[model samples]
Target: MRTKVSKGKMAKLLSVVDRTWRAAGFKIVQARPKLPSLSAAAPDGCIVKFSVGGFGQVRFDAGVGAISPGRGFHVEGEEGDTFPKAPNGGPDYTPDVQDRYWSK
Candidate 1:
């Protein structure tokens, strides 16, 4: 599911995520620098490997799609997570896409 995060606060949020991941010794790399598929992504979310505690090193995607600059961006942690199975036979993940909307 995606959340609408104001563009003004986007930088702050990205900074926090960057610092947190970097502090964890994770290097963020991009796949296609040019025509990036994941808008406002930390490099290529495809190569980001995150430590999921006992779950071992689970690769995660940290890119926001469907970007509305100055509005909000979408973030897809992973396909499964991004589109998690729904409960009570309801729809899957909210938005079914990872994106962030500008709250402001």
Candidate 2:
């Protein structure tokens, strides 16, 4: 899908995402606007895709999506995959806990 936001705005959004994730101690390999496919049946929407090294990729819809101010954006990750288990044997979603585990 084409993004409602301009290219400059999208770049700023991705920069903020990269900075925020890095500040929280997560390694971001790449974060950018995904290119549209050449096939005739390809979806018409655009997505901001990001990859966390050794973990997985995440896609965020570019239309009407905001990266800040109360979690306005939508994100989707790969299915049937799991992040590193937490210390209490649950999923590790917190930045502090994830940093600890990923640091090892």
lDDT of 2 at 32: 39
C-alpha lDDT of candidate 2 relative to the true structure: 0.39
How many pairs of residues collide in each model?
14, 3
lDDT against the true structure, per candidate, is: 0.41, 0.39
Clashes of 1: 14
Q: After superposition, how far is residue 83 of candidate 2 from its true place, in Å?
A: 28
Highest lDDT: which candidate?
A: 1
Range of the 10 consecutive residues with the lowest summed lDDT in candidate 1: 50-59
- What lDDT, from 0 to 1, does candidate 1 have? 0.41
Model 1 TM-score relative to the real fold: 0.34
Residues 1-104, candidate 1: write the lDDT tens digits. 14444436445555565567667655655333222211222443323432221212112344335534586555686344334467877654332332344345
For model 2, residues 22-52, the per-residue Cα lDDT tens digits are 5655544343344311111113233333422
Model 1 misplaced regions, further than 4 Å: 30-46, 49-104
